[model samples]
Target: MSPLPGIVGALLVLGGCMVGLRLLQRRYHPHPELVRKLMHLCVGATALSFPLLFHDPQPVWWICGVAIAFMLALKYVSPLRALLGGVLDSVDRFSLGDVYFLAGVAVLFTVSGGGLTFTIPMLVLTFADALAALIGVGYGRLRYPAADGVKSLEGSVAFLTVAFVSAHVPLLLSGATGRAESLVIALLIGILVMLLEAISWQGLDNLFIPLGTFVVLNGHLDRPLELLLFHLAAAVTLTALVLLLRRRLGLEGSALLGAAFVAYLCLTLGGWPWLFAPAALLAGYALLAHRSRLPGDIHALVALTSPGLFWLLLAVYGRRPELYYPFTLSFAAQLACAAALALPADPDGRVRPGPLAARVGLAWALVFVPYAVLLGAGGLVPALHGLCVTAVAALLCLALRRARRLSFELQTTLAATASLFGLAPLGA
Candidate 1:
């Protein structure tokens, strides 16, 4: 298989996409969404053909770089922006979807461990997501705006259905998913993807659907019943928390999901015996949230999402508890700092970065030092990981204050990305 053919195919698709989008823009000036979806469909379809086009990973990288470069070019280049209405004309201040799309594609090519992993993310994105966009607008009714989006129950269910079938079909054909595996794991992945999609706004689904689907598929729940029960319990309890706190705290549905998922993942990975620290700590925070009147800001989000993400990654990938708990404790300390920073300081309600750092240092000393001492050297990497997360989250909040609004959800989510270990692994 000559690589030249695949490379040529990719180039042609890229050129055609630019030209086609221009044609569409001239013809359908008012239909920005149509133009956008068309772009999504074309790019996704092109990504789907990668395996057929390139026998090796090198060309995939070349294609990815070229595509990303082109997207970036579109952003800065005036004529190109005019031609495509700047990547689908979403309300987001920036084209996050373009970055997400390319990242998802690159992730699939680089990280997929063959078999089901290679195909599932691509299939759902290429087919299920595209289908959902079309079906959601056409057939959707009984809309819920805040919890999900302008999405209706019918459309959400439609996405789940297609996602589930898309997941099962390729694996079934390739003999990667057996009957039992398909019954539970595949179904769960589909449902999870749908839940994420429901919460997704501004085509963030381009990122979450593919990457999240990949993670869930890779987690490989061996004792499905146990995790299922745990997930259910956590989801229910956290949702109840959302109901209780939403009006007062201004928490979003995604925040509720963050609480729920970490509750499950934390307890599951740590097992029944290891639930004490998180349980006690969170309960204490609940009180602080009440008495302190914590603002539902991005700082609070960073507080929750840290533990949530670390627990999730730790459970999924951290096979050994000895080494990971230190990292977990470090994040715990950071969470405490995040919680404190969520409140106003001194007589004034303003938060200063200097005092915030001092408080964070104190919190880390109070929590991480003791926990790390208890755990010994096993906690080193986890502690470093946790410290770095807190530092970066704080710095980013400080740095981008003028540019981006520091919402709780985005802050917490940014912290959570740290927990994902940068899409690598939990390591030394």
Candidate 2:
């Protein structure tokens, strides 16, 4: 019952599994992916026993820490790599999945104290993720681009189905949530995490799926049926709209789905006002930029929206109203920068300042005017101040582009800077 025994036993089990996997690989010569999935299931299932074995989280943390350290050593240490290569290292893809798996276990245990929240995510990560991989490889025919590679739609659907069942059956059996609410919550989690996994690059899904499921499941545990239904509707509608207009929006595959999920969070977390800025920016970009000029990848979308996302979280969860202005300003700045860069250039491959200024002005107005109108007379000062700062940021970004050829990094930096300066008028 004590943590010390559980910790020792868990460590031993981990060690045994590794050695057994190595021996099995040597004798049977199973596929590398099959070996990796075996490791995933064995380790994750062992971790599931933590709540039963130890009363405190410290022991679980110790096991996870030790496992992570040993796995790291196994990857790099020549003798260990040679010994374990057929197990984890033989897979051809670049993945930090093994490390992320251990880290997710530690994080989930700490956050949920090894309750249903922890159990559900672990279940999804272990069973659903592994099944999806096997099914995708075996049955996948419809493929689309993910982060750096392609994934099958069949695999995504399998993940969604398994995740929904994994989340629903537990809540339904526990009787903590009503059947209908459980269904909604599970469906929502399935959809969101499926999208996350689809877009993830380099095994980041190992980390994102569990945490993202935790956030969704934890947030919706006791909500009313109507609210849960609304969330479900919102998610479905957003996904549909993104898919319908994917080409026009300059988004496809993982990028399209990622954008939809991101927008859904903004709407759900901070309501319509928060959603307005991104909506306007998206619409403005779709209208103004040529199809060739629009961003169609997750990396570019993150660069564009992360600044506003940062401010949105601060405003909503941190209960900082002033941060709302910064959130809107962040989007405005990004829109301005996007507009400036997207305009047509002269024969010399240079954009005239007049057209660039006009484009930026149009984008700024498209995004900010509605915001100003919504804020009424009192918000006029902050809106105008944000406008000025956004212009300066756009101009500065252009100068950098002219000098060094503009990069997503500069665009992100300017967006964040403009949002920070958006605080000045609030102070005044």
The numbered model that scores best in lDDT is 2
Q: After superposition, how far is residue 25 of candidate 1 from its true place, in Å?
A: 3.8
lDDT of 2 by residue, 43-102 (tens): 989988988987767888899899888888988899878887568878888888989988
lDDT of 1 at 108: 78
TM-score against truth, every candidate: 0.67, 0.95
lDDT of each: 0.61, 0.86
In candidate 2 the C-alpha lDDT for residue 274 amounts to: 82
Instruction: Give the per-residue lDDT of model 1 (tens digit) for 79-178.
Output: 8777664445543334467667877787777787334676788888877787776776677775554333356667767778888898777656766546
Cα misplacement distance, residue 368 of candidate 1 (Å)? 14
Error of 2 at 120 (Å): 0.9
Clashing pairs in 2: none
| Top TM-score hit | 2
